[model samples]
Target: MDIRNRLKTTRRNLLGLAAGAAALAIVPFAAQAEDGVLKGKNLAYIAFGLQYEYQVTLVNRVKELAAEKGMSISVYDGKGDPSTQTTQLLDVVSKQPDIILLNPVDAKLLQGGVRKANESGIPLFMLENLPPEGEWVAYNTFDDVAGGAAGADAIAKLIGGKGLVLEVRGAIGSGQSEKRYKGFHDQVAAKYPDIKVETLKAEWTADNAHTLVLDAFTRDPNVAGIWAHNDEMIRGVVSALRQINRLKLAGEEGHVPTVGFDGTPLGLERIREGTQDADVGQNPFSMAESIVGEMENHFAGKPVAKETLIQPVMIWKENVDSPDNWGNRVN
Candidate 1:
């Protein structure tokens, strides 16, 4: 079978196992933190899937931090199923974890789960994308809108504020995607009015992005730059450009400058090779570390910020290895 199919199958298996384990276990309130470290302090990490490399990195970071703090982390991979996530949340709620770190499939649909956790007197640390509404102990998010704006601004600067811009948006209903799109458009409207924007949704996938780019280029040949919400989509966008032998054709004169978010290895490689223009890197490792700290503080009856914002780095060849750069720290 193909890679996608294999990935899908693996995700299904993981999800099934996670759901079953959660159901079988009847966890009781084991123990709370004495000093800084919480012994047997239960924490639930509910994710959509472990298929994505970012997700794997982030989850592993959480596990690492938990191990350091003497906390127990029970994970739930929903296998891209919202219903399964809801069920898992219910199971996690029954276990009565001290904290619930959630990355929801749909922000709006997760309101009930958030509410349930809250009603159970559990602190919630929402990572990355947020729910549509409700209060959590901490809402950790990157300035995706700013990242998008920055990416767009970078493109505009490269083209001297005048060019045909092609935008590769992420999946619909993804709060980060929406924010990124808004940021990009807002920047374009303010800083580069001479530049026209044409957007196509890539559904947050490289393959979809490739297909979308191909279609966009078919209609508009003079697409000067491509700004994607995620690096995965950016890779797809580049793949599409390369496939049509239009990689050199889409630039200002003859080279299309591409910018993306999530400074993943693939995107970094492109940046190193002088193909991808820039990427916004959010340090998931640091975020995971912070979450553990907050959880420890909460267990110790100390105050923690209800909302935490992590500054993202604009990564390029020049700043790739700078002290402030976010490398493979997620590992």
Candidate 2:
């Protein structure tokens, strides 16, 4: 071929390559534009209750991230009542916000509200607890069942796999509470057959837990360890033990090894103080990140997962101070 023809062919190939590179660079910017569409959108978060530390932290983190994205959020507390949550859900559905985040106080009772949201075609995201029937954009929550099993294992190991252990349960009919109860019992029966667990319903309140634990101890002072559904209940358990003169530090005589779920700052503090032995840690911060990210993905026309379960971590005094723990990150 002639030299002129060869030069022309090389120039055309270079131009094509340059054009391809430029197009590749613009792709990310285009995606950024899509992601930024969340700005000015409205979100309604219906929390189970704000009284508990874990729920408070989760809701606060969601609000913080939503604010950073320039989104407006309205929060409603269910106050641990199914009726209240149902009312709030219906009201929020009527308003038809861009997105609805629901942490149901009772999943069964909220089915009607969920169905209404579905019929209304509003995007609904579930947190912690999922309604029995609903079409959700995504459900982001911790593995409470696994967390319960971890607590079982901790308590069993502490008591040498054979002893009486008291279980401070959350509210009856709560999905998370039921799962934790089932997980704890299933694990104990399957893996630690010698352990005996007596349950007391506390309704996820500190006062109830304190009273129940105190009464249980009075009836059977031979209890070796205790497992509570949440850190808040553990707080009551600690107070009860202290009142009964049974609150002993780890490695001390007569010390009742206590295990709890929810990696709240208070739980981590108790672990450091040696009163609480172990905690099944759930990363609410990560849950918040997932919630916000899923919202963005939905707005950006991306596919959202049906469910995302954040794994639970077992935290002991040995690793309670790790900054990776959400409890440690909270100010």
Candidate 3:
């Protein structure tokens, strides 16, 4: 053990330690690079329609998230037409994007397209809607049934569970619309026996809802409350009431309590203004996150849940200002 040999041994050990540390650091960076599998991936999102504020927000959030992840996304508006959506889905499948995200206007009508995507070997992800027959990597959607039940409970409480409440229903063949209608009816039947719901088909449009509400009020002036499947339809209800001089703020005498689904900015604003009661809110931002996360998982060869249901939030005047409410965060 000479002094020179001892010095050489110590220096060699130090070099070895430094090399090990450098390799350890490289490991993490390599893993991080692997985790970004979504980068440069192409995503095709077939939205149910961009006509509604909620759908628009959902599409925008997805786009933003995709951009952040260095992924590219193409969005197609279904225009609220099932046949058109079916055509678009087929066309998108032919393009052979890395992934396909479908928000169907009618689940049944889109099953063929879903099958086509499956046959093409393209991974399919569903948002806010699901078809009976399909092979989807993951499906992310809000609990429409729960949202409807919440709306029913809110309206029943406001109306004292005894009166003729008008229900502004959405499109006939839409799965979400059907679920909401069933949930509202079932909840009312099970809990609020004295409440009678009169149905009006609005097709998820403000003008249709406005016309229907005006006709209903003309037929019966004693309608107690209103529950709409969406905030857009509620807007129609508001205009019709105002035109007839029946609109009143909450706590005012003869104020008709209103409950709506989809916590759009208008819904939150009305809640703040005391013109609306409650909104069963489906967070589009959250839904976008869930779906995009699942897409990343699929690309990374990680396990993904077959279905993810983001719970609805009950937003009322008391909590409309909460930052967590998607309505408040929308640009």
Considering summed lDDT, which 10 consecutive residues are worst modelled in model 2?
A: 25-34
Highest lDDT against the true fold, candidate: 3
TM-score per candidate: 0.84, 0.88, 0.89
Q: Residue 164 in candidate 1 has what lDDT?
A: 87
lDDT of 2 by residue, 1-331 (tens): 4433543453354344334323322231111122376887878888887667677767767776876787777778777899999999999999988889999988999999999999999999998888767789999988888888888999999999999999999999998899899889989999998899999999998899999999999899999899999987887898898899998888898899899999877788778778789999998788989988999889999988879999889999999999988877755
Clashes of 1: 2
Compared with the true structure, all predictions reach lDDT values of: 0.72, 0.83, 0.84
Tens-digit lDDT string for candidate 1 (1-331):
5433543554454455344444423342223334455777777888656655455556666765666666777777765556787888888888887778888766787788778888888888887767777777777767787788788878887777887888888778877778889988998888777999998987778889999999998998888778888786876877797788866522335788888888765566567665688887777677777777777777778898777777767887777656454443421
lDDT of 1 at 294: 78
**Model 1 worst lDDT run, 10 consecutive residues:** 24-33
Q: How much does candidate 3 score in TM-score?
A: 0.89
| Model 3, position 312: C-alpha lDDT score | 84
